[model samples]
Target: MSKTILEDAIQEELSFFLQAIHECVHTDFNCNRVLNNAVANIISSVVSGKRFEYTDPLFVKFMKCLDENIRNIGTANVLNVLPIVRYLPGDLFKFKQTLRNISMIDKEIIRPFIEDNRNNYDDSNVTNFTSAYIKAIQQRRQEGQNTNMSDGNLETCLRDLFIAGSETTATVLRWGLVYFLNYPDVQEKCFQEILENVGQSRRPSMKDKTSLPYVEATVTEILRCADIIPSSLPHSVPHDVEFRGYTFPEGITVLPMLSSALHDPDLWGDPRNFRPDRFLDTEGKFQKMNEHIPFSLGHRACLGEALARMELFLFTTSMIQEFEFRPVDGVSPSLQGLPGIVYRPQQFNMKAIPRAK
Candidate 1:
């Protein structure tokens, strides 16, 4: 959809997200679930012209399933290489369960949502992404032009929007919090940038992005360092190819190790360090590097890249303005992340200390 639509969605849901944190904040608080719900609501807002209350049953189930599928992806992907193992029985790889998860999501969430959008198609006012797609299909049919905008494709797009859009963005946010816990100085620096540029009276917006170079750099660095979707989605070998003294057979699954590019030593001399300044130029302005590919590069890159960038900046700055993420008992969080479909931080506890005005 359009950038304005996504921006509006984030701006609207951000209040609820901050409120959820306020209620849940304590000596030991895990904001993961609430973060997921908030991001999902943004997707819901864009997809169906609706947003779910954090406590709603469907909203809860929706967040749970999205998380479950992400948790399952690492294990389920193994069946891709050893297809025969599925016949051996049991949900060892969770491949069957992953299928079941998708079915559940489609039945309980996606199908009903898409059907509702179709049943209530509004041509005069195409608000959300689904309605907009329906409008396009209708226009195509009226013009007597065949189009691939079928219901099945619409369903797949909706699925991609929900799963990839929500999970990756939310996971990156979580990783950012973990990093903040580990590097409070960097966290404070970001907060200072927001405080100085946007101020306490106003919320940080996309307009503040260019003015807050340090904050922007921190977000960019988080995306680069987290590199959550390191291998990206698996792709089949298009043809026999030769690499550095190695050959791959056609049809073999190639997990492009995206981390290699992101963590390349030549690009960042000290790639292992969590230094946001690496993204800043000598004049202290945020500058992007061609080697950075957290969303994966080329045609297979993420569809929600723009939306993801907006969410990252808005959520990161807003949260920092509201609270200082701290480790339990002043201890630092481990930077090592759990590798899966998305490389994410291991479950960790931290406190969100509200900042003084």
Candidate 2:
């Protein structure tokens, strides 16, 4: 089911990219907006069984809200440690405002879909996550089992899946473009690999990944350098646990410093450099490392990791195969982007020159 959804999304994403480039009169474009909408549409289809056009007003507003809320939420905030801080003015930390914005999204954006799913609930036909959840709630009631799949809970879950699943992938792609623009040689290598593996007559797929080792390594390097989610979400230690001679008591909040491993000098030599060769073995094949935990580790790792991987590979290869990305007007974009919930590249324009077939 997930594979089908991703395959459909990759096709749509490639079409959207082509359309965006064609519409650019001067060949100048904002890759960030195009990438964000492309990714968000995937989640929109999965969660609500509907995909919105890029220019849809309500959909644009919802995207804006998600972007703002994500930016407002950094690695860690004082509100998490002190509940009293939220009682202060909304302008102080933007905490209350962020919550209010998200609540509006839940009420205005998610509630309507939940209502529709509930009204049209069916036992056998489960088209999307919303429908499957509604069906589960009904089935649980029929069996008289204790289930918490209430409308509100369902709405929150859907919202989480939509935002988390969309924004992270979009940010990573945006950064990927930035890196490629900064390093044209790397971009050309990726394009060459894609061309040799998957010809211009067809779109690239997961099967092409093995044949395009450099492309795979390039994607790995982009994720390592971008560090979208530098700090994983807060995880609680259930009971007193001791690891490496350190005792962590029960109920302690643990923040997995992923950057520590991703940028470790011993693990990754010259970890600060944007080099895809680090992920490639001497034989020119992609090398998988235990330290390469971009989606993170453990059972509670990213639920959408598989989908994200497919999106990254397919969308990136499609773009490289179709266009040669370059900085607009010979202006280079800064690598150090504004850090929010995710590390985002700076707002910079770029040109996607069509490649000769």
**Candidates' C-alpha lDDT:** 0.87, 0.84
Per-residue lDDT tens digits for candidate 1, residues 1-357, read: 667778889999999999888876766987788888899889989998888898889878777777888888777777778888888768888777778778988888888888899898877878898899888898999999989998899889998888888888999999999889888899999998888888999888898899999998999999988988777777877899898999998999878888899889987898889999988989999898888888787887887899999999999999999998888888877888887777888888888879999
Candidate 1: segments with Cα more than 4 A from true spot: 236-254
lDDT of 2 by residue, 160-230 (tens): 89779988999899889899988999999988888777889998888788999999999999999999888
TM-score of 2: 0.92
How far in Å is the alpha carbon of 234 misplaced in model 2? Answer: 1.3
Candidate 2 residue runs with Cα over 4 Å from true position: 85-90, 120-124
**lDDT accuracy of residue 214 in candidate 2:** 92
**TM-score list, all predictions:** 0.93, 0.92
